[model samples]
Target: MKNIIYFFAAALSMLTVKAQDFQGVATYESKTSMEDMKKFSGNNKEITPEMQKMIEERLKPMFEKTFTLTFDRTASTYEEEEKLGAPGDQMAQGFKMMGSLFGGGGKHYKNVKAKTMLQEKDIFGKEFLVSDSLPSIKWVMGSESKKIGNYTCYKATAVVPVDKSNMMNYRPKKGAEEELKKKSEDEMKKTNFMDMVEMPTERTITAWYTPEIPVNQGPANYWGLPGLILEVSDDKTVLLCSKVVLNPKEKSEIKAPKKGEKVTQAEFAEIMAKKMQEMQEMGGGPGSGRRRFGG
Candidate 1:
């Protein structure tokens, strides 16, 4: 009886060690959007200063938001390799030209901000919300599953609708509104102008998660899965986990954003609007130039 009890204890210890030990790479990918400046520029051969300014203003926010959300994740550290440009000859050329024109011969133009969120929760009970800034966009998972190497994977999809609800509180300068009105009218006359409607800008994200790990956390705002997302992708983009080390030598303590002047989502919109107005006045980018300061 004594020998049997000792044997049982040893087996239990081994099981515990296995349950808490895992090491693998997770890859995540997402489909995103970029402004079609080529179309607009093509229609108007002579790009006016105002048109250029408008293009920069519009594309800057969209790019900023997309880049932030696409790379945001709280679990398992990662290192981004190289970012590929949009697929297709025309699109690729357009991006290259734009980069050269705007970036002064750089490969691409991007302003990246790295942020870390401490304490958060997911299906795994508690986690961190480590991600870049992204506007509230929705997506759905698709019905697809497969085995990548040794892991079973599934597909998920979501839609990021074009938000045009005038969420900003800042108004343009005294004469800027008049300029916009004139531009609107001119644009209408030049092209088929229809009332803006909600369209399905769908992004199908497929991921491989394993219930064996039992953690719902994933990169960005994506969660609610049965297990951690090991690999993810959409039609145009792909993010793969390069490496994962579970049960590290030191545990990572997740925390949340606590310093900012806390405000409701609506209030945030208002603040953003006001900030935009201030930027226009100062001839700065639409971004709030202030960083979160401390971690």
Candidate 2:
């Protein structure tokens, strides 16, 4: 009986050591579907087949992207990977010509143990770091399971609240603000263009996580899970982990990004909203000299 007890204690210690040695880097492929964008163009009369092809081709780099998520026991950081442009292709050449016009995304850091999150974003030429509480998602665990890569993952579903005003930025300048002050709120919504109707909806999120990892971290702002999220998707975008290296030889530095204009999420949204409104007033939309910033 003493020998049996000693053997069981030794096995438990080994298991704890193995769990402690777990640090992983996951490579994810992200894709955003463009089928829904077609619905927005009500009788696109000016859209020729040639124009459509060019638009579709340009959308590739935006929709199809690769990112790396470095995670440990309690936190994770997600950032997009830079890629080399292809050579000797007309479509690629076209994209390269407009390279400086787009691509300014943010870095996301989530610390589940601390219940904190930090987002570093770039607006035009300015950088801002928005810190907020970890998103509170009420996830309903599901019995369905599937194998993604080497991990057996279970499904979880949630309905996330969408704030439309927070998603768009349209802050008006002094002159526009003064002129716009005379208009009522109803008139503001009627004349205000740019399709801000996506607000006030419940977006569904479906996630698949594996308990084998036992870390409540995932790419971007996703968290509050019992294990590592292998795949997650909403209607427009999907993040799928293509490769995960557990106990990596080199562990990445996990720290919060603190170099930017400090602002809360709500404050940042207000700033963006005012900026967007001003830009639109100055004839800024669909090739109006104002470049579109990537998220």
Candidate 3:
């Protein structure tokens, strides 16, 4: 009898949330910590604490971003707010620009009903509309619960591939890749892949969701939860929902980005790989590379 009562309570909760239209917007504040980079690259070259501080300040705009997630029952669009002007030295400024090109800040659209996604990407000024199937996450539900703002939240976790969260942005030559594999275990005995290489094959993502607001929507490429995800943390970053407005006076224009040349995720990866290889050949990355993006 107790179990039956609990089941009906859950059913009632779900039905209540579903009865009310959940068309609104959630604003998220994303912060990227550079402490990891500082520790790794601190001794890579001659650098001082003040210098590190300068780099951190320069990366402020990119590290601290505001993302708006406009969502409804099964369709949602997430995009970063326009950035303000940045202040830094020439080198810092250059690094910031490089981050914009190689790293994040893109418009992402997810449709749970259709199981599809349309993402807009910018690689070195060239735009690409990446259209593909939504990557599924095998989320393991947890018994933990917490309160986020006015909503009571529960926990969930997932072991996701690194690429599902972000791109590598590094592409070695065909021969170089083979050469790396050819290295004997004895030869690499002294070298540490953890401290030296970017091993982003897998990552564990932890998310906090609010069952009170039962909507399968979240920021970025995350969704399909029984409720809206209010906070998510991974290896490199944490995105928290700072504000949520339900049934806003003005209806949001939730539309997938239609600009840029259409390409699949794999297709975009190949293009980026080719471009990186060429750039490295000319004079880039750790070694060197060529530039000229399809020029």
Candidate 4:
């Protein structure tokens, strides 16, 4: 009994010491399907080959992106990898407006020890610092395993509650436009734009983590795993870690974003909901049965 206790104590001490100095940089490639993108256009007419090609060209930059995650034991920052021109610059003009609807413009910081999340976002030329509690994920560990590079990863799954502002969950309800057409103009004017779109209250997430990394960290808002998450996917998007450099010579400070107006995640959602409604009322945007943010 004494030997077992002493061994555990020694191991715990080693882990603590190692965690103090451990940091890593991981690069992830994110990709989403464009098949559903046409739904956002609200154009029932069949698309010409030229129009289809043009649309794909414009959306290519938005659908495919690279991000880097810098992390320590308890905290991390994830941001899109810097490239030529600003983000969304190459996207179609309409998509650039919808870009603000998604929350990927700036650094996303998460601290596991503090159970807090802070994200910096640029919305319609204004900056916002969104603060909130970390997402509570009850991951169901699966026995399935796979090899991602040299690391052996185990699968885990969870159904996570989606924030009301998460544009990824927005899908135009079926026949919403036809139903709207039947309403009087006054009724339509008074209609709540949110009712036209469907936002699933929760979404299923599948994550593959590697125990070899020994850190509860991942890309984007995902965390709370037994190890570092290497690959994660929801219904439409997949984030796969393409490269990981453990204990690199250059370590960055994992600090939470302090700039921009402070607001809770719920408050941010409300602000966006109102903004979207306003756009709808103008006979444009999502309310016109067009240009909705989608996964």
The best candidate by TM-score is 4
Off by over 4 Å in 1: 1-143, 147-150, 158-208, 231-240, 277-295
Residue-by-residue lDDT tens digits, candidate 2, 224-256: 888789899987779999998877777778777
Off by over 4 Å in 3: 1-21, 86-96, 99-102, 164-195, 286-292
Residue 206, model 3: lDDT of 98
Which of candidates 3 and 4 reaches a greater TM-score? Answer: 4
Rank list by TM-score: 4, 3, 2, 1
- Per-residue C-alpha lDDT of model 4 across residues 75-162, encoded as one tens digit per residue: 9999886445554553454455455475457889999999999988666657789999998899999999998877778999999888
Candidate 4 residue-wise lDDT at 247: 77
Task: Candidate 2: list runs displaced more than 4 Å.
Answer: 1-21, 84-104, 163-197, 286-295
TM-score of each: 0.42, 0.76, 0.78, 0.80
Error of 2 at 33 (Å): 1.4
Q: How accurate is candidate 3 locally (lDDT)?
A: 0.71
Question: Which tens-of-lDDT digit does each residue in 1-295 have in candidate 1?
Answer: 9668746655653353356343333444333333233333434535777877766654442233212111112233332233455566443444323321121111111112222222111111111222233333243655677665544566655554321212211122345333334564356345321111122333445566644445555654345565556665544334454444444454443323433243443443344345445544544432323322121
Using lDDT as the yardstick, the better of models 2 and 4 is 4
Error of 2 at 72 (Å): 0.6
| Candidate 3 C-alpha lDDT tens digits along 158-218 | 9876653243322223354344454565644443432233435677899999876788889
> What is residue 38's positional error in candidate 2, in angstroms?
2.2
Model 1 scores a TM of 0.42
Compared with the true structure, model 4 gives a TM-score of 0.80
Note the Cα lDDT for every prediction shown. 0.38, 0.69, 0.71, 0.77
Better of 1 and 3 by TM-score: 3
Best by lDDT: 4
